[model samples]
Target: MDAAVAEAHVAALQGEDAHAAEPFRMSAVKFAMWLFLASEVMFFAGLLGSYLVLRFSHANQFSEEALALNWPLATLNTVVLIGSSLTMALAVSAAQAGQAPRTARFLGFTFVLGVVFLVVKAIEYSTKIHHGIVPSMSLFYASYFTMTGCHALHLIGGLVPVTVVGLRALRGRVDGGKVELVGLYWHFVDLVWIFLFPLLYLI
Candidate 1:
């Protein structure tokens, strides 16, 4: 009877161990990404809040300075970013479907669109600089450069992961989870620009 009890106890422990070893319902990497994004949301909220305070206090100055921004160019860049988001979605779908080549193709498209966005932004920056419009020139220009520069940096950081995942996909090693995580980040970056474009250019 003692031997039988020992065997049953060992079985119970083994079952518990197996249960503990099961994967999380949500992946660890995905959870980490969500946490990171949450922090980013708070960071941007602070920036926008500060900008709004300054903008309202200096309404006429802001309105006058906003005119210097090239809304048409910004609008074009918005469309390009939106297109990149669509391609990123397609890449995620392809990865989920285990279509590695298709995933790579879509990732390449997304990368190109992202590059186009940066190039247009660079042109806008050059024009502003040529006209002596810079961050130190005014509060409005300072906010504009700070917000857009941070967003651009995020996009540049995201491209590295996209390229890595795309290369792996090309080698028939597509990870849907990684692709989805990257998509989450890319979409967030695009969404920020969506808010920023209208706020700085149209508003």
Candidate 2:
């Protein structure tokens, strides 16, 4: 064959193979995740907005009700959550590097930290309830519980996928893209808590 025809043939074969690749590629998955996160952003935005409106509307009562929260426990949970985010990032890095064992270990650590955060939050909730600071007691209490409760639910939901990913990593079945998607979600959860911690506990 002539040199020009030979080059064209090779290029055509490469194009065909590329076109025949998997339909559900990593880019598709990442795009879907971005869309999902966008919706979650709006949902959380509404919740935070409601909480802020309530807080500012009843500033005096809100301050008094905020005094009922266990700042020490909340602060501790914040630290645990931030630590978990770090571990989650490391897990993604390991997955990308194709180190399945390391990925699994980091993911397991992240899961444990998530559990610790929930435990501390549960303790704080019980303490507040014991002090008669239930949601119905005041607007601040209501906003606080609703915001944190939704967050806790998200954390619980996130744990399931994290556990599954970690198990898959142990079996050397997880791909880097899946790990990246999960990491995005985990980071979002941690970021929400970062905002909530100071908003509810400190400020």
lDDT by residue for model 1 (30-130), tens:
98999999999998999888988999999999988887689999999999999999999999999999999999999999999999999999999999899
Q: Which candidate comes out best when scored by lDDT?
A: 1
TM-score against native, each model: 0.87, 0.85
Residue pairs whose backbone atoms clash in candidate 1: none
Score candidate 1 by TM-score against the native. 0.87
- The residue pairs that clash in candidate 2, if any, are none
Task: Write the residue-wise lDDT of candidate 2 on 1-203 in tens digits.
Answer: 69999787677667866554444555988989988999999988998888888888888878776765778888888889999999999999999999999999999999999999998888888887888778897777788889999999999999998999999999988688888999999999998998888788776
- Give the alpha-carbon lDDT of every model: 0.92, 0.88
Candidate 1 lDDT score at position 203 = 72
lDDT of 2 at 108: 98
**Worst-scoring 10-residue span by lDDT in model 2:** 17-26
